[model samples]
Target: MTEIRLITFDLDNTLWDVGEVLHHAEQQMRQWLDANVPEYTRTLDRDALTKIRTAVVTERPQLGHNVSALRQEVLFRGIVSCGYPATEARRYARSAFATFFQARQEVVFFEHALEALGELAASYQLGALTNGNADIQRVGLDRFFSFAFSSADVAASKPAPDIFHAALNHAGVAPQQCIHVGDNLIDDVHGAGSVGMHTIWVKLSDQPNTIGHTQPSEVVEDLAELPGAVSRIHTA
Candidate 1:
């Protein structure tokens, strides 16, 4: 059996509950806007801002991968709509996005996430392949990865082959020699599988774990169970 040479990971939801983190980050941004630019607080409330973000991504599909730019653009647009001049809008957008970003990086990891990664990192070349803007360095997880590629890095997100291929080439490994661990069935499991890599699905819940009736190569309940699952897959 071929040994797994490189292991790539998904960030949000796989390592931490991203939904809660994002919600808190949004609240932080709202508070900042209320204190600094009070008009935006009234005009770009949560729901309104969500619609603006959706519209920005919808109109410029490529912005989906570049979350930082997408966010800045949304803030700029929102501020402009609320009667701010273009110059002040841009300035405020940069400052506001920075505030939200700091809060976003304050992630609370899942149980045993760091311990399991430490164990795996000893024997394998670890990498991160995420569609989010989460900075491994900021999150104190940079020590685990030899390389980390985000959608911003590759100009494309998961379920696409580009980011997967980037990680494979970075590690100088073939698809069969790599394994991708992620929580999403389609973007993580099927995405890596489509590129001919092995996959481990981090099934956090008992929800249906199939992509159009096709199951992942392996499934684990949490990061604590990941090391054993990877060991089994390496020799299978």
Candidate 2:
């Protein structure tokens, strides 16, 4: 294998507990809505919210790649459905999304995630490749990553080659010289492998490795083990 010159990461779950962050962010957004748009909050149910979101994605397929836009559009339609005029609905949508987006950046990093990235960044070019809307800059990880790409940036998400290819192009490295580290088996392992890049799977020790057929070059249960995994691949 070519020496690993660049290491790209999946932002959401690889470095932080995204599930907790998202749940909290959603709660924060709900509180904001309840305070500012009482009528919309009173009328909107889970089913109704899902319907609005679905309609937004279905009607405007391009928003599928842009989660932030998709979410704002959903909120706009939901508010308008509650009898707000288009201008007021648009303003409310932006404010609600701002609340959500701000809360979303309040992420708790996985144990030793920062230390691992700090160590690896010293020797290799580090980049972020994600399908989610999490901004590395807003997440306070911009110091470590030389570049970052999202589904919105490439108009395609992982499991497709667009994101991985964008990372390679941005880093100016061949696929063989890069390794992608992510928690998802298919998105991280199979996606990078398809483009001839190596992969390291960051599965928690307790999680079941159901997709064992999609192999990664390395596997680390903890972020502390990440640097060693990359080193082993580098020296191979």
Report, for every candidate in turn, its global Cα lDDT versus the true structure. Answer: 0.91, 0.91
Candidate 1: C-alpha RMSD after superposition: 1.5
Q: Give the TM-score of candidate 1.
A: 0.95
CA deviation > 4 Å runs, candidate 1: 211-214
Candidate 2 Cα outliers beyond 4 Å, as residue runs: none
Top TM-score hit: 2
Candidate 2 Cα lDDT to native: 0.91
Candidate 2 lDDT tens digits, 1-236: 46889999998889998899999999999999999998887999999999988888888888999889999999999999999999999999999999999999999999999999999999999999988988899989989998999999899878899999998888899998999999988888999989999899998746776766678999999999999999898888
The Cα error of candidate 2 at residue 46, in Å, is 0.6
**Residue range with the least summed lDDT across 10 consecutive positions in model 1:** 206-215
